[model samples]
Target: MRALTHLRSLLGSILEKKGAAWPDKATIEPPKDKQFGDMACNVAMLTAGKLGMKPRDLAEVLKSELLAADPALSKVEVAGPGFLNVTFAPAFWQKTVEEVLEVKHCFGKFNLGRGRKVQVEFVSANPTGPLHIGHGRGAAVGDCVARILRAMDYEVSTEYYINDAGRQMRLLGESIWVRCLELLKKPVTYPEDWYKGEYIIDLARELLTLKGSALCDLPPAEGQDICYEYGMKSILDGIKKDLADFRVEHQVWFSEKSLVAAGAVERTLEDLKSRGLAYEDDGAAWMDTTRYGDDKNRVLRKSTGELTYFASDIAYHADKYARGFNTVVDIWGADHHGYVPRMKAAVQALGRDADDLKVILVQLVNLLRGGEQIAMSTRAGQFETLADVCAEVGVDAARFMFLSRKSDSHLDFDLDLVKQQSMDNPVYYVQYAHARICSLFAKAAERGVAMPECSPALLARLDTPEDLDLMRLMEQYPDTLANAAQTLSPHVVSFYLRELAGLLHRYYSANPVLAASDEDLMRARMLMLAAVAEVVRSGLELLGVSAPEKM
Candidate 1:
């Protein structure tokens, strides 16, 4: 701890003197390879260019400064060119780990969020249908963002902005109602534009059971409205249940229809107009989005005077900012990338900073079976719903797979790999690592062994590459969490878990936790194994995945 403390300060001082306004926040990241040293920094190289000096020379100076500052580093050496190689005293590793045990999973936590009130609005799919796989990824990403923000110490609010409005719901209702009548021997064919999904038929049956011929023999227009309500509610309820099983719960379900019914759209338009950010053009109201770097200005209200999704978004964001959130993050599908500029323009036009709104576009998922993509037809309801995938691979595996990839990258949710119960499945491997530790601990207890406190043997004990590798890996866990929180990428933790499990499995195979000699060594190694378990479980928990103690 003293070594790391001194090194951070020394580096900060050296960088400040190089005339580039102190590297306000520079992370002393662990180098990818241990042979390079316990930790490595490009800070010297970074500052060397700014200082107009050779990087190697700069590193030499910093090395001396670090050594003088903290002798406990064991050795501070420069490797390659300008790479600052830092070594922790063996005792330093032991003591710092005591801190890990004391702090538990709370280790490496920072005041990054500082309790700022931020809300994540995601999976606002219309209640017109069950959630499909695409919707599942968004839910996982959005929910994880909220989870990370909260863990980073923010006053986070997670919301589900229900798209309960729009013509789609009406069409859905009409489709279901007609499908109902069609099933009842009324033989009603849907309008050319009505929904053709099988869900419509089921909804129609439910409506018939409750309303009987009361809804039958009626005009499609009347039945459309009634059935739209019926189908929408049914679908919405179904979506909520599906999401809840995936561990997604909303602090609020902000309604799309309410923005219009409550007159927020008109009020927001007026607010924009008052700020000279909006105006009428060719019988349409346009927001000067070009000012905010949009390709062209956008229509807020159509020539017909109906508000577009943009207008509702403006109102929605207005409400988000009004709720006292200094920053608002919107996670959306990649197809909505073109919509980002206009939304930010709206946020700014409402007298708030456009930069305050961060829109993350997660690319679409390509659901696959065997090795080929499974093309889906939403119209005929041939697409796999989130619920369907859950039923096939289970909620845990489904959610874990969705969170494994960078949300920006198009993920292929391979039905085959997810169902695999072997090392091929990374989630299973990580969970098994946790479970293996439990098995080892149980084995120890069966032999009347108890966990040992830190001792001279445990202190001098960890010398194996696997052992040090695990320690160094554990050290990165906190910063890993902080960085994941910073980028809103919970997948980083997923990736880290794989590496952690890899280390655990390798260590288990290379060395035995229950040894012949040195009973204290067994206890010491087991204590480290416990640390591995705790870290893996903590990381998995943030992603809403299970850290199984028994597979």
Candidate 2:
């Protein structure tokens, strides 16, 4: 980081001295091949034309300026067209060990967000049935994104938009009512679209104990309404518990019904109408979404005087902005990808920038066991619930597996592999690396080999390729986390942890730490291992996965 900062400063100073306009940003990245250098910069190639100098000639000048500004740079070579590959003195890498040790678990945090107020809404599954494995993926992705943003110093508010006012809730109520009638041994007809989950029968039995058979005495509509309200609340309660168990706690549970009751939906429609963005056509209100890139105008209200689902969503988004959030992120199922443009258009019509509303479409999860796909259906209540999967593989494994890929890609969660205690299981591998480090330290203590204090002088003794590779990866943590937050994806965290763990395992097999006779080398290796362990723990924490000291 210091090297890049110094390079940027030197480039700007040299540009100003040459009476040339300096670029606002410069790309200074660590080279992929270690032989290239500790860091590489392409500022010269990028700005050569602007300065009217040949790329290599410009790079030579910047390289000289950078070396003069930072004596820690051992060498700077111009490679290819104009890339400046830089090598840092050994002391620079050594200093990073002490720095990471001093910071401990907070090593990967970056201030890139600058405290931007953002809200992340994910896994807002309706209060209709138990959350399945698909919802599990969204929960993990959304929660990790929120965690990464917070790590980047964003003021993030996590939310779950409770879709409590939709047709699903009505169906849930009717389902429960019919189940109740069945329990009462009364003749009843069931709708084909009604929920068929066994939980409805369970709910009916519970309702029997509370309301008894007296509910049957009321008019059918009244009884169903009573069931709808009670069923919605009960299912929502279950949903809350399931999320809490999965370590996903939302700061807000915004209810859709509340918007209708508070007249927010009507007010939003009125505001759009006042802006000439909404019009009535044949007794139905329409939004001019096509004006903002939608495929066609969308219906806001039907001729029957019923607001469309899109209408409620627009009002909800308006509420999100009114709550003072500068950015609002919605994590929806992958099936909703087509819904993105329409929602963005609605935000524009509401007088807010479309970019302020970001949507992440999470793909489905296919559960596999014994090399065969398991069938699932939420309506029939025969799907693998998130809670059940967690119970089988444990929370750490479940969270890690769900976040192991891009959210938009389908994940075939192999139950057998993740539950293994071998290298085949990534969660186990990473946690084992941490546990191995802890065990090594414990054994060292038993042998009266105390960990010496960290210092540049001792750490400089580490010169092997393995040692340098570990330090390089650890240093990339802040950048990797920033990328994850900027992209709104948590898969980066999982990938980083796995790579770091692989390096640690390789180092453990090749090096002799406590057994080494040289005191300085042993201390340096121990300090390095400790830093690696802390980094692994920190990365795991970001993914909401456990880093156990013991397997």
Best by TM-score: 2
Evaluated against the true structure, the overall lDDT of model 1 is 0.81
- Report the Cα lDDT for candidate 2: 0.89
Q: Model-by-model lDDT, in order?
A: 0.81, 0.89
| 1 Cα displacement, candidate 2 (Å) | 4.0
Please give, for residues 1-551, the per-residue lDDT of candidate 2 as tens digits.
55566566766788788877666566788888879998888878878888899999999998888788877778999999999998877667666788789989878786888989999999999888888999999999999999999989999999999888867888888999999999999989997788888888898888889998999777888999988888888888988998999999799989899999999999999999998999999999999999999999999999999999999999999999989999999999989989999999999987889899988889989999999999998997789999899999988899999999999999999999999999988889999999999999999999888888888789989878788888878877877887898898899888888999999999999999987669899999999999999988899999998888788
Instruction: Give each prediction's root-mean-square deviation over alpha carbons.
Output: 2.5, 1.6
Please give, for residues 387-500, the per-residue lDDT of candidate 1 as tens digits.
889999987788788889899998988899878879998778888999999999888889998877756457467766667778767877767877788777889988989998
Candidate 1 residue 494 Cα shift, in angstroms, is 0.6
